[model samples]
Target: MRHLRSLLFVPGDRPERFAKAAASGADAIILDLEDSVVPARKADARKAVADWLASERDVPAIVRVNPLGSDQIDADIACLRRIAPDAIMLPKAEGAESIATLDSLLGDLDAPIIPIATETPAAIFELGSYRACADRLAGLSWGAEDLPAAIGAATSREEDGRYTAPYELVRSLTLFAAHAAAVPAIDTVFPAIRDESGLAAYVARAARDGFTAMLAIHPAQVAVINAGFTPGAGEIARAQAIIAAFADNPGAGALALDGKMIDRPHLIQAQHVLARAAASLLPSEGGAFSKAFNRSKPHTTSSR
Candidate 1:
């Protein structure tokens, strides 16, 4: 499934934010009805989200409903029926049971799934089985906040502002869960709104750890997230060189390229990088968008 490399989460209760989130340059927008919306405003948020989904728009809009056992599930389900989002973000997903329950509830509905893997105690142990019910599932992600609190952690971060070791374990587990399920491994949001550098560092860490995308809380975070996840010129060149150096080497099983090992796995990795670079190259928009006068950033594929 094609997904948003940068997904911006907008509070469903905020009508003004919902409208602007579409054009905020995120590949998708998550109209959040869970944590972002207060308990009293949930009904109002659901109504607003339902209305927004009916309207035609360029952005791939999704609704993040409350957890399965919540009192708001009925309202969330009703809102989903009306809105018909691209996918449903299931927060606090427990395991196969929870997914099976959702499937049973909405048996005939066609909406896809994107389950957040870290939420509660049960979620951590059941993560290995999370992808068992993946017929309609898109990917997996982890939350640093909920799981830590569920286990009675004081905070989710380290002194250097990185996720604590416990949180890192969850993140890796989420990545493996998606990979095992043959789906995208989405990274969680960077909460520091004003710390662009910190956000970039976090994105870089996630990308290096094999996450394909990230959640964004603000419009300002979108561009950096997109750029950070995308493979650049140096990456593409190195990938190409790796592929070239290994090709037609009949006598050698493993060869050295730039003093680094170039083997079967490395070749596979290189090709994957090139593939992502190719996929991200959208057709240059002109006319109404006016690409002629605007200076576009010279990208990885531009020279190619």
Candidate 2:
């Protein structure tokens, strides 16, 4: 609902790329201090990210800090205290307990969080616990890169780069968790930047499967991700027609459209499509549009 269709990742240590990433048309930019920065460069990366955030205004950025139990987390928290980012991306999120702990730790700062919820074997068992901290989340997302290593697997994908069985399950659970929490479900990174065809197909599949947004490792993939998630003119027109049909006949429970029977279920979907379209037309810097779909009430179909 926040139109986070494309969230690009930039290394925190690469200060020169910060401005470039801001201009890349990505809905949000994540300054990654965890996996992207080596242990020796952690301090420097934190300083660079803090300096950039201090100088820049109107940049929609989030910081990917070290995992909850890592030693570097203290330093990350200190850095965040000095320079408040728009949001925080928590890596290797275990469950509600960790989230609660973080909530206590951040006491006054209390920035919105987006957790990479499926990176460890233990994380697979705690997907349901996210609902407890749903109110503080910007959205929910998962990662395939860390899971394979955690599970001692050679790869998490097939020869074609599609997720294998285990990781596929993780992806689905992440989707349901986000929806259950009434937040957006952002898909994991595609990893292969040069394969434009592969990236496009993967992103289309993600959009069709109810993923609200996607994480991009490179700037080149942002355009493709944005296009894949944004509703096309034909889809917008069809959704509008369905809404109009239902509005025109207030007493009717169902109606015919394009020679097919339209019902309550279809109407509900059309409304969602239109809502997403409207949100897309607005800015994507986590402003007023961020809470457009963060409703606690279910978006159920109306008979009228």
Candidate 3:
């Protein structure tokens, strides 16, 4: 919720990488206990994650716990109760019911929940339910990897590694759902860790599509993701121009700017952009380590 432009995942079984992931400049580190950890290493991963939470964490951390109804869910909840992380990331969350169940289990822990909202076919229909538990939610993200497998598809992507039509629909729905629920829509990870150009294009498209944040599978992707999502000079200038036009033409329903009609909707859009850009300038709170300073490009929130 704190302008999470990039969240990096570290395998829960690999405690050696925990500190490294924290130092990678990501806004938050997700200790993954599900897909990243093998079946046999689950218990060990849980122990390692618990131990890390028990100790001092220099970065904000989220635990990607095992899916609902898994044998490991109980243990995951137990560890969470012992030491609640900043938030809990739920995989394969079908609907509000799973979230409600987690709420009941956690009782008064008060940890925010971020569900992978498009992992299953059932999850596609459950997007609307997020609004009911919006207050307990931190952010909403969707994955293209698991959904294809769950639905028995050959692949979730095209040969170019772009999302296929069906998975694209899932992505769009997740975006709308997150906005509808009044939470940040975090784009899924670009799994091709080595393909920096592909990752850059993907993140750029995500930011253009109104995604407030993105997930990163590797440290190398964090800086690019953060830069892509952060409001750039051109964007801030456009927002300021739009706001100034509206301010000058008080009580006018619409105004002309650069030969284009700027209406109430455009004014609102500009204000939102400025607001998010302003938020990006705030210092990290609660020892949340970030490599945002790595950005070489200048970003100005000062409206002219």
Candidate 4:
């Protein structure tokens, strides 16, 4: 579908919160069956999520199933077979092979996939391989929490909440890999839910670093994420001016706009800004997103 500026996660077991999350101003809601739910509750969560998805809903629903090869995955897939979500969020995804594997398990289900691409150590090296299965992807996102635990690190970030060097490397790799695969680069969740100022700064950095959207842990963070990703009045005005200047000189490679030299690259950037602005204005209902998912098919390619 269009770029999701914010995707709020709601625990699959907590069905009571599903409707609240759908109305939390987020572009979509991720029914988390992975990290959020306890092992004892996975089956119940799957049933709850299936029941919810089986009914009609206004917002798009993306179910975050347990990681591949886990005992819970078979049941997760079975639940999906009963009632398909708008998309599947595959956690601990390693690359094209991971996507291909999930696609096989999904069978005829036509939901799109969004992989959390950098959760394991081996996944770091597999980032570039996503290009092989980009057509099956909705976007690519990275997580810092699991990586640090996987590597036995004390923490993934510094005292200031900035990511350490290794985590930074993975983050940048995930960003470039998404672009290389021609998919949206989705930033990871900001864990400090109460730190609104910090969240704003993180969102600003994500937008500046070319992230099309961000994950949200709390409903309070949705509005901030949406506002951060949407173009401001000044930004929209500049983008419009750039487009007008390019239009005025159809065959020119470069032109002066408001006393500054603007080139083809500038025009392309302006177009992207306008596109994001327009996407932000679209209705949050699931009609458009469901149609987009139905139209999507797994890209046929040999597993890596």
Winner on lDDT between 2 and 4 is 4
lDDT of each: 0.78, 0.84, 0.84, 0.91
By lDDT, the better pick of 1 and 2 is 2
lDDT string, candidate 1, 204-253, tens digits: 98889899999999999999998888899999999999888877675677
- Model 4 alpha-carbon miss at residue 222, Å: 0.4
- Give TM-scores for every candidate, taking all chains together and pairing residue i with residue i: 0.88, 0.92, 0.92, 0.96
Worst lDDT 10-window in candidate 1: 295-304
For residue 128, give model 3's deviation from the true position in Å: 0.9
Q: Tell me the TM-score of model 4.
A: 0.96
> What clash count goes with each model?
0, 0, 0, 0
Cα-based lDDT at residue 63, candidate 3? 92
In model 3, the worst 10-residue window by lDDT is 295-304
lDDT of 3 by residue, 19-80 (tens): 88888878789999999999999999989999988888656888999998898898888888
Residue pairs with colliding backbones in model 2 are none
